[model samples]
Target: MIETIVFDVGETITRDDRYWASWADWLGAPRHSLSALVGAVVARGQDNAEALRLLRPGIDIDAEYQAREAAGRGEALDEADLYADVRPALTALRELGVRVIIAGNQTSRAGELLRDLDLPADLVVTSGEWHVAKPQPQFFERVREVARAAPSATVYVGDHPANDIFPAKAAGLRTAHIRRGPWGHLWADDPEVAAAADWRIDSLFQLASIAKG
Candidate 1:
């Protein structure tokens, strides 16, 4: 039985439209241009942040983030940013006695913002808080530790194949590949992603059934 359901924030629980749009505005670049670059970077298996660097070579992303914040524009999330199904799906899982957690490759401020939303989750955390990011075994180890369950009893759900499905499967957890965002749709039909994911779903509502199983 799946006792815990851990989620990736970007393009899973949340749509990244505003997140990337904000970056485009900050860099004074056309939003469509940056979005296209992000998709291209993902297609090449490059980090999505490479899109920003392509916009401004040698750009210090971390410093730019700090500067954006100082200038009154930083990471922002609200109820509107959430997927339409997020609330209902999470609430349903919790009602079913399934432990729901939100842990993703997000910043500490993003974590705080997620917690502030008060979603029906046992915990909300981020790579910035844990000092580790995904595609790394240590990240999933932290996930298992925080889940307080055997790896097999937990399910990791996300849209990214390399960062979400592959590593989580390697960690011995059941994996759900959600086809929602760029990476999700782009790699959804890949032979390896299909093989790695224990479940392939297009909607968060599908998780209710996975939890029950």
Candidate 2:
């Protein structure tokens, strides 16, 4: 049985419109322009960070993120940023006696912001705090450690195929491919990646019905 259900934050549990809007400010591009660029990057199966760098050379992602946080504007996900189904789905999973964790690649202060929001996540960890990012085996191992559950008995849910599903599966965690967001939607039709997921969900609302501890 899966005793823990860990979710990817941005675009998985968090809708992330605010973050992109910030990116728009940094690029001095309209929000729609940034969104379109992001879509292009996703459609090409490219890394989001790398694509941003390619678009704006010498862009310091971390520095900008810190500056924004210092100004109390860095957290991309606000109360309004969460998907409508996130809280309900998370609460339902918690009621099943499963440990629910929200872990993702985010600024160092992301956990602090999320805590204030008080989402149902039992634990929230960020790559900034953990000193590692996803698609790296160590990242998932840290999550495994924090979860206090065997990797095989844990479920890793996320919208990214290369980052979340593949790496989590490699780490012996069952993977759920959520078919939303750029990464998820762009790759949803890919035969190989789609075939690999232990679970495929259209929405977090379906999580309670499918992921049983």
Best by TM-score: 1
Question: How close is every model to the real structure, measured as TM-score?
Answer: 0.98, 0.92
lDDT of 2 by residue, 112-169 (tens): 8887889998898899899999989999889899888888878899999888988998
Q: Among all windows of ten consecutive residues in candidate 1, which has the lowest summed lDDT?
A: 144-153
- Model 2 global lDDT (CA atoms, 0 to 1): 0.84
lDDT of 1 by residue, 1-213 (tens): 999999999999999989899999999999999999998999998889999999889999999999999998988889999999999999999999999999999999999999999999999999999999998999999999998888998999999998999999999999999999999999999999999999999999999998899
- Computed on alpha carbons, the lDDT of every model, listed in order, comes to 0.95, 0.84
Q: What TM-score, to 2 decimals, does candidate 2 have?
A: 0.92
- Structure candidate 2, residue pairs in collision: none
Stretch of 10 with least lDDT, candidate 2: 68-77
